[model samples]
Structures are given as structure tokens and as C-alpha cells.
Target: MAGRGLHHVTLISSDAERSCRFYACFLGMRLVKRTVSHEDPGTFHLCFGDEAGRPGTLFTLFPWQRVPRGRRGACEAWQTSFRIPSGSLDWWSRRLSEADVPHRLDQTAFGENCLTFEDPDGAMLALVEANPFTQPAVWNSSEVPAAHALQGLHDLVLKVREADPLSELFREVLGFTEIGRNGKLVRLATHDGAGGTITLDETGRLARGQLGAGSIHHVAIRARDAADQDALVQALHDRYGIVTTEPKDRIYYRSVNFRSTCGLLLEIATDGPGVDVDESFEALGMGLKLPSSLEERRGELELLLPSLPIPTCNRHVFEEIT
Candidate 1:
């Protein structure tokens, strides 16, 4: 039950380096760490969050180039969001337009005004104004000024063909409760102090989303530590009769993952031994890191991955700060 808050969202990409740059430069986020994915060491795994690489502020990138592109359907989470300041929506519009990024012409939906855009890999990204709703970021990045930087991931929409077993698991197993519903969408949030919204749709038909180019691979939640993550894993198994692996070290954190009854893969990751434990933020994200078992193969892993640069953003917020 240490599922404190939304720790991070992991997504699939064709090129980790490209995603690393786009998120850093455009969003004012810093690439805090780079490592070959422990599960699939052949691919690059990158994490971008605030300067300290805090838990709730993370956006992770995985390059699984060989996989086919996934289709966006009712069952698939098509878009993940970020909140900019209420009045800064105009500035974001101009910025995306100038970059030649295709954004859904500004629109109002779900009580917020947002300019939706796609990343180089095609993940549906949105820059929305935190209007009518106003508990702003306690801390924000320089790239997106305090006034315009992304607040954080608000909610995720899941397009499900059916919501029976999925809804029950979310309640009985995952500790989420029904907050609200609109038409065919059911919104569920956890009581664990994080703001994650899962929308189950019955009529929002969508094809199987391809997992390549730009798509979310899995949604990961934070566990206080190995013990907490274990408890969650056990609770899941006991509640639903689903078995999961013992905790596995992910270098930065320990994790236990399982695909839910709804077919959505969810992971519970420990919050300790962060990406900064071994390196300073000044020295962050510069090299490929390997686990102790794979330390001997570091050279091989490095050779397979792309040569990467330290991710930094050059947004002109300093001009405003002056």
C-alpha cells in the first residue's frame, strides 16, 4: 500500500535519443538518467523528470524499434497530458506552431483548454491550460516557466471494450474508487495520494494500438520500498488470484509488474536508489549504465545503443526571468 502517487509513465519509441531531446528542449525537462532496459538490455531506456528526478514528475522513454506501430483504440491509452498555466495556452500554441508540430487546434474538453500535439514518435501529447482548476505546481522547470511549464500528468484515458472485470479489479485489487463517469467513460482514482485517472470506455471502439513509434508501453506506480511493492504484488495475487514475480531490481528502483485483468500492464516500482544515487545532476544522463550482473557486458551494451549527448534545454525563459 505504499502506492503514494503517480511515479512515472513509460512509453515506447523508435529512437530514445530523439525523444530524450524533444522532451528536454520543448518541455524544459532534463534527461536525468540513461540505461539499457534491464528486461531488454538491447534497447535504450531513458528517464526525464525535474532537476532532482523526483518520483511524481517522471516521463520515461523506451526505444523498442523492432516492434510494429500500435493502433489507437478505445482500449488503448491514446494520450497522456500536461498542464500549462491558464493564460499561457496562447504562447504554447505559437511555440508548437512554429516548430511545425501538428497540434489539435486548441480546444476545450474535460473542463480544460489544451493544445494537443504529437511527439516525433507519435505519442499523443497535450499542452493544456489548468483553468477552472487551480492548484498549480509547487515546483516547475525553467523551460516551461512557472507560468507555463507543465504541471504534471493529470489523467489517462483507457479505451476498453468492456469494463466489468477491469472495473472490479481497479476497485477490489488496485484500491481505486469511482470518482465520476461521463457517457461510456468511467473515471477511477486511487486514495494513495496520487492523481491518476483511468477511463474505461464501452463504446469508444479503437483498434489494437501499435506499441511502436509513439505509444505508452505500460503505466508504472510508485511503491515506498521493496516491502511495499511486495505487499502490493501479494495483494494483487490474493485479490485476483494473479501471480507475479518477486521484486526485481531496475537499477534505479526495484519493481514488480503484472498485466491486470483488463489486459493493461501495470507495475509497482520502489521509490528508493534513484537515478541520482551514483551521479550528480550536473553529470546526469551522460553515459550508459549497467546492472552488476551485466557490468561485464557494458561495452557490448554500449555498442548496441546509440551514442547520446547530455540532454539539456535551451528555452528562453531566462529572458523573462531577467
Candidate 2:
């Protein structure tokens, strides 16, 4: 069966609030969820996306303040790109400049206009004009106007020492169609090129990537629901003899994870029980909303974490809660 599309891409951050300012305020995404990492309570897990925090639009970050800076190399996701409205590249370039975020305007081998930049923590990101046929939800709270706001994730780039095995996994297990190649970079897309694509780069000679601050943790592919996830999990174990985790409730969605051939983490996530399930649509990311297990200790955990604003870019979407 073919994968639906990209669900979300989760990455690391050195400071949650700095990342928030870049993604929510500068980039015009909405902060849809505020929670602590399931495995760690000292750090924060922030989810940013379109207004509703839809599956394909979601991007998450785990702020680990003490982690060392990561170096981009083979066996790592080098960049995460977003789709922007056609002809909005100029607006974004100026906006990023206003925020003092360094960026450069460039084009792909296929001649797609792209604005490439790095986050505060040095994670690579690009904004590419989307296919005009597809429309993205408008985020009204941004410092940017709705017409120029970011759409959602456009694609990801994975650099690996060897491409054949991982390429096989992308086509055989993940159901991505090999579209075309540019030298060492091979592009693959799901859902007949309608959804986000992943470019696997066969970096000839490079060190193995080390995950730390500013590195992508995993790339999630969309699965319809519980049964669909189950089928994919079983296929991994039975057909490919690859081990996959059982479905786990992530509050916003259900997920199953496995390590790829090159040790890159991959996840399959469902699209339901969305961002509004725990918080109201209008009040998303307003305050810390913890799971039932952590609810009793909410006060303690809240004190342990740093405070963040509601992503208004200093223009005030919601009154600052201090």
C-alpha cells in the first residue's frame, strides 16, 4: 500500500523560545501544542503547524538546552523545507532579514525558486514556492500576512554514505516513487507527487552524523489510522524482518517507529485526535498541557521549564500571559 504523505518532522532545539520565535512568529506557523517530552521532563516538546495542526503540516521540536551542537554529515536529515505561496519568496527573504535570520535565495536543479537558511540552532531549512494547484491553510496570527505565510513542509533531504539499501527501503517499504536524480541526489515522492517528497543524497565521503542540538530526530510518514498503522508495522517485521515499535499514543496522534537501514529514525503516525483534543482551537499552545500522568505534578514541572510567549512576533495575537 502507498503511504499517504508526510505526517510530521521532529527535530532538536537548543532553546524552545528561540525556536518558537523563528517558526511561529517569523515563519507564520501556529504553536499548536506545549508539552514535556515523554522520556524527559526537564525539556519541552513544542509542536508548530498550520492553524489546526494538521498531520502533514506539523513540525515538532524538543529543546535540550545542554546538548552539544550537531554536525551535518552522512546518515542524517540535512534539511527540512516548507511550501510557501508562489511569488512570496521575496516577502520571506525580507522577513527573515528583519528578524536577523540569515538566508540566501537560490534555485533547484529543476529551477524551483528556494530560500535557504538555518535556524538559530543551525538546523537547515528552506522555503520553496509550492505547486500552485495546492492551497495551504492561512495562519492569521503571524507578523506576516496570510497570503505570504508559510504553507507546510515541502520536503526533506537525507544524506547517507550508501544509497542503494535506503533507496530500496524508500521504494519498497515506504512506497515512494523514484522521480528523478540530480548527480548524487535522488528524489522520491509519495502519493503520486501530490504530497511531500524526500531527497536522498548519496554523500560520497563523510563522517556519520551525530544527533544533538539542531538535528532532526525522525521523519514521520502519514498513516490513515490504527489498522493502517498495524498493517505497516506487521509488514516491516514479517516481510523485511525489520523491527517496529507497537502503536503508542502521542496525545495528538498514534505512532509507530523503527530505525532505517542507515540508522535514520522513521515513524508512521495517524492523523486523528488532533491538536484541539487537549486544548481548545483558539487557545492552543497558550500554556503547558501535560498528560494525565504528569497532570498531578504540573506545578512542579512548569517551574522547571522556561516560560515562552504565545508566538505573536511582539504584535500580540493573544495577550502575553506572564
Q: Name the lDDT of candidate 1.
A: 0.69
In candidate 1 the C-alpha lDDT for residue 301 amounts to 82
- Scored by lDDT, model 2 comes in at 0.81
TM-score of each candidate structure, all chains considered together:
0.85, 0.93
- lDDT per residue for candidate 1 within 1-322, as digits (tens), equals 4235467888887655556668877776667788778878888888876666766667888877545666665455667776556688788878777767777756533456777877776688776665423343323545566666666666666667787677787776566787776677677776422245556666544555556667788877777887777777778888888887667878788888887776677777778889888787677776677778989998888778766666444433111111
Candidate 2 at residue 76, lDDT? 81
Highest-lDDT candidate: 2
lDDT of each: 0.69, 0.81
